[model samples]
Target: MKLPNPFRKREYQILTPATKVDDSILERPEFLPEEEVKRSGKKTAAKQKKGKQLEGLISYLRKPRAEEGYTVLIAACIAILFTVFAFFGMIQAAGEPSLTVSAAVMSAMLVSAYGIYLAVRALRDKEKDQLYTWVGLSLSSLVMVTWVIALLLGLTT
Candidate 1:
């Protein structure tokens, strides 16, 4: 004899789609007519135009004034001067008998890498201020100065 059925299954009746349902009965009585829909479309267009005008006014009010060019020029000058000094120092060091060429080269490389990183970051951040740009440019110029000095000293010997 088979052991009493260990598992009992529940029986469910299959459902068929309702043939008596009327789809029209589900619609609301306040349905918009075609003309009303067109009128609503026109209203939306007018609203969008008004929105754009408001945005234009807001932007004009919030826009920043032009920056002073002199500030940028000064920053650039400072960057250039520093770069020149750094380069001269590197060159003088290289020319000295006790200085190691490897250290000079490494310092130059580090300055160059750091300059590039700063420049890229400033650009990505949309930094319109000339200060960051000047700093980055100065750092990059310093790298060039160091490299040139090392080369000059190496060749002079």
Candidate 2:
């Protein structure tokens, strides 16, 4: 009879001894110690610097024909505002076409039309960024569509 040795490796299996690890490698580094800590606002300074950089970039992007952009922005604001007001007015009136509701809707349509015109003008400017211009145009177009639908419904009823 053959006796098997406990430390002998089997033919179909392989094993390796574990290697020693350094304490430095095993331990995680700690945060800044209390003695080394200071009252410097480094994080705030970095955030402010980043904010200034973003502001500068935005100003640079908006450098061309700024007035047209402003107009488009104003018109878009007015259109959207009046459109919402008119919608609420209509709802309050219970679908009744009151003069105030009609006026609000008309104003919304006019402002949206103006916004579209300003957007088109901005688009024609060779150096304009056109980001706000496109946004204004889309918003105005949406208001205009909404007004038209309201008008059509009013006419039908």
Candidate 3:
């Protein structure tokens, strides 16, 4: 036993014989400190988000005509042609008069539906072509209502 003093020189007692420690772990980047690990995780997540945004923007720019209304226009044209065929068939029907009338009514309804589609698309994209948007909406609405009225009249007669 040693007598305790107010202070003594600091001494390290050997608890065990010295052994080799693997210093290779220190060179590994994964052995980062706690704060560095947290910061890296946040940075990686932010980078991923930025990459995804860039990918989306790149894909959008890749489209040939992102705002083309050609599909709606083609649908509208088909509806018009079908409507005319229906009328001609009904007026000069050699047989199946109802078929012609029904065809006409269906075509009219299709036109109305296409018009509504165009209108909604225009509004969604906030299109600068205001006149075209209004025309599509009004034309669809008018054609739809007119067909409905005609259908009722045809049934009554």
Top-scoring candidate (lDDT) = 2
RMSD of each: 14.2, 13.4, 16.9
**Each model's TM-score, in the order given?**
0.32, 0.56, 0.45
Off by over 4 Å in 3: 1-69, 94-101
Cα-lDDT of candidate 3: 0.63
lDDT per residue for candidate 1 within 6-65, as digits (tens), equals 586755657965445423443322354657647657445556767998886644334332
TM-score of 3: 0.45
Q: Number of clashes in model 1?
A: 0
- Residue pairs in candidate 1 whose N, alpha carbon or C atoms collide under 3 angstroms: none
Off by over 4 Å in 2: 1-65
Q: C-alpha displacement of 124 in model 1, angstroms? A: 2.1
Could you tell me the lDDT of residue 20 within candidate 3?
50
Residue lDDT tens for model 3, 52-128: 98886644333333232454545555566666777678778764577657867687787769767776776666424
Q: Rate the local accuracy (lDDT) of all candidates.
A: 0.53, 0.75, 0.63
